[model samples]
Structure formats: C-alpha cells, structure tokens
Target: MKYIPLRESKKEELEAWLNKSNEILAEMKLETNPKKRRAIIHRNKSHWRNDDLLNYLKKLSDGKCWYTEARFVAEYPQLEHFRPKSCARDEDWKKCHDGYWWLAFDIENYRVSKPMPNVKKGTYFPLREPAMAVCDPDVAITRESPLFLDPVNQGDAELISFNALGQPEPCPEPAVDLCEWDKRRIEFSIKRYGLDNTELCDRRKELWVAIESMISEYATNAKRATHNDCKISKGKAEQLIIQLKKYLEPSQEFTSLISACFLSNKVGKALYPKLLTQLLAA
Candidate 1:
C-alpha cells in the first residue's frame, strides 16, 4: 500500500473524540479489577466506534481498505482495531487472550480494513513468541513487537515486494541479511491479511499485463519507422506518461504495487524517466 497521509475530517473534530478517549484510558488505568476495567471500557466503546471516525479513516484511503486495498463500498469496511480492542486471538478465533481494552476507545488504535481479511486476521498479532513473554492485555503495547503491518507506517511500504503475477514476496532490500523479525512479519501479515487474495491478485496482474502490453505496442510502432531507436515519438511518450500517472492516483487500487512494478522494469524506467520521477515523487 502507498503511504496514505491521514487527513482528519473537516466535518468532525477528532481531537474532541481523542479527549474522550484519554478520559476512558485514564479510568481503565486506575481500576485495579480487570473485569471492572474491561466492563467500563467496553461499555464506552461506542464513543470510539463513531461514524465520524470511520468516515475520516475511509477518507484517508479514499474508500479503500487501508490493508487489502479492497473497495469499501462493495466489501464492507470495518473499524479494525490494530491491537484487537476486545482480545487477541490465534489464526482461528478458538484461542483468545484479554484484548487491548484500554485502547478500545483510542482513535490511534483504529483502522479501516475490509471484512474478509479482518475476519481472517482476527486478533492474531503474532510476535517472536519464545523471546517475547506473553503480556497482560493492558500492558501488551509496551512489551509487544507487533507483527501486523500498519498502512499508516511509511516504512511498511518497503516491507512487501510485488510481482507481475500479483503475488507478494518479502522485500529484497534486506535479503543479504534478512531480519528474522521482518521476514516473519511480512510472511505472517500477507497470509493473515490476505493481501494476495485470489481476486486482488487477479486485478493486480491485470494492471501489470495492461501496462506491459502497452509498452510492447509502443515498441512495435517504433519498429515500423526508419532510423528507429526502439523509442516512441515525443507525442507517444507524453501519452504513455499520462497513462502511467493514472495508476499513481490515490483512487487507483494497489498503487504501491503498480508503482513498484513500473520502477522494477528497465523498459518502464527508460521509457518514462520523467514520468518515473513524477510517480516516485508523488
């Protein structure tokens, strides 16, 4: 996923909602009884589960699921608590620990994900288990090395590598000395989040095939001309540039993958050097 800068909604004051969040967190922290604290916070979850917050988050991704790039309108959008607000679970929902109830009302803990992946993911926030101790749900945030990837994190953009087949691989940046933590996170997140769900992969492959074919067509046209350098005319170049830039828009699904595909190909880099600069800059 491309780095989607979260622009707070113009219709609502999120700071006001965050203030309510802080108030709830404060109460949860002070209560000694875990059951009482959970009940209190769970009771007030509606404050965090506001329409304003969901709308603001959806705005951030232009109605795309922040994780899977799924369309929010067709597939239902959920306010996925990155830190499983109720409880953390295993791959299946069978085993669960006390959820991060303290952050149940915290806006920062919220994200917009499609229902399918979110359900598959459930609360399976796997860390390097043996090395990391099981933390109390209340204190998990401090002790945990979160395996799930957050779309808001700019660094996550580099953690995944995409191919023309529309499948994801661990990014090759750290291939020589791959961090076990990162390798696990990427592998786990992809499987759990279903980033390469069959339908999603098919769409991504369509993009790759489309762009790849267009470039080949351009070459064929160039071959028909004398003194050909396997290059299109300036007019053709401008048209190609416009087409490539369309994928860079936020409205486009899987822009990070699209951008990566173009940048990885030598022909794409050479054909639209200026366009490459523009896409990367965006």
Candidate 2:
C-alpha cells in the first residue's frame, strides 16, 4: 500500500458521467425505501467503471492494486469503491448501514484493486466505533474513523511492516512506534485485505531471499571498495546499487514489502546510508 495522489481524469467526460450519476443519485435519494435505493445503485453502477477513469487510475499505481500492491496477471483489475456504494457491512459481516451512495460516481472514492482482495473485502468497512457511522450523505465523512488502512493516506502505508517470513505485521514500537489505534487498524486491515494468504506470503518470502542475497553481495563489494586500490570492487558496488533501486521502483509489485524487508535486517541497515548516497549519485 502506498499513497496514491488522486487526480481528475478526462474532465469533460467525467463531468458528463457525474451529471448522469447525480441524476440517478437524486432519484435514489427521493426513494424512501432502502431496497429501491440499493436497486438504483446496482442498476447505475456500470457507468462508474469507466474505461478512461480506470486507465488514469491504472497509471497512478502502474496497474497494481492500491491496497495490496499486487498486479492482476491472469484476471482483469477491479475498480473498488474505497467506501462500498450500495451497502456497508461491519467486520462481523453484519449489515451496518447504507453505503456512500453519493460518492458512487466520484473518482476520489475509487481504488484499483485485484479480484481476490476485492471479493474478500466485499462491503465490509470496519470503523473505530459503529456509533460514529454516518448514513446521511450530507455528513462530513471525516467524522468517521475507519479501521481499514487506506492506501490513499501515506501514513497508513507506513503502519504495515513485512518480516523475513513475508508476513505483514503492524509495525512494533521499536520499528516505528505505532500508537494503539494505528496498531489495531493495521491488524484489522491485514486480515480484511487478505494480505497474509499463503500464496502472497510465499512469493514475498522468495523476493526477500533474492533481495537479501543481493544486499549481502553489495555489502561485500562495499567492504572491498574501502581499499583505495580496488576500482573493480567500487564499480561492482555501484552497479549493485542500481540493481537494488529497481526493487523500490513504484512500478514494481509489492514495493512496500520489498522496502520493509530491505530495512528490517542488520546488513541492509549497515549499508543503508551508503546505498542512499550512491543511488542518488547514480
């Protein structure tokens, strides 16, 4: 998960879509029956998954899921409503209230997601307190404290840390000194996002192993480069720096996990200062 800088896409097209959506929303709002309102949302949902809008969002994350930093290779990507549109459910799968129907067409509420996690997430939106939940579209959404870690918030991305085992965990106090609220949010989000599923964890572990080996080699080269006569070692160290930087590139999948694994160990930390200097210089 990383901070996605949300931007408007194809303004004229979006505005036209929004106008159509607003008309639908207006119709739904007037309907006093919840079932009819949900039906309206279900019927009108197709337009919001606009190709232009989805392409713009795909460019934002380089075609990776916003929450999991995963790319869907075998299947099509899903456009997730950061807040569920038709119905909102709690952690226990109990229906809480009507979803953010007003923002159904609003691009700010959209997230690029993989099919698996999108299905896993469903309509579940865990809040800090269910009592603080707002049903009225007029109410400021900031009044509700969401338990799921949002990728759109840069700080929320930092709250999750990966281990050598490739499992995601809430950053311990020693690592990042998280507050209890943040810790709980991270914990809940990990489960909700299905980030620790065996396949993902195994893939992450394999990546970590490869990266650790490269770091080890880099460390050895760095030590040899300390010798004034070792030009070959210095060149090798610089080349390794460039390679390592690729792992952290935004276009790469699971970059957040890659970075966490890089900084979690002794050798990586020992070389961190020099690595940053060379990466910038390179």
| TM-score of each predicted structure versus truth | 0.82, 0.87
Return the lDDT, model 1, position 93.
Answer: 50
Model 1 earns a TM-score of: 0.82
CA lDDT of 127 in candidate 1?
A: 52
Tell me the whole-model lDDT of each prediction, alpha carbons only: 0.71, 0.80
Best by lDDT, which number?
Answer: 2
Per-residue lDDT of candidate 2, residues 1-282 (tens digit): 677777434456556766787788788779888787777878877876777777778888888888878886777778989899878898789999778877777777888888877888889997888899888878888899998888877777778878888899876434457778887888788888899889999988899999999988888888888966588988998898888877766688888778787777787766666666655676
Query: In TM-score terms, which candidate is top?
Result: 2
Off by over 4 Å in 1: 4-12, 90-97, 129-143, 174-176, 219-234, 271-273, 279-282
- What global local distance difference test value does model 2 have? 0.80
Off by over 4 Å in 2: 7-15, 173-176, 270-282
Give the lDDT of residue 33 in candidate 2: 88
Report the Cα lDDT for candidate 1: 0.71
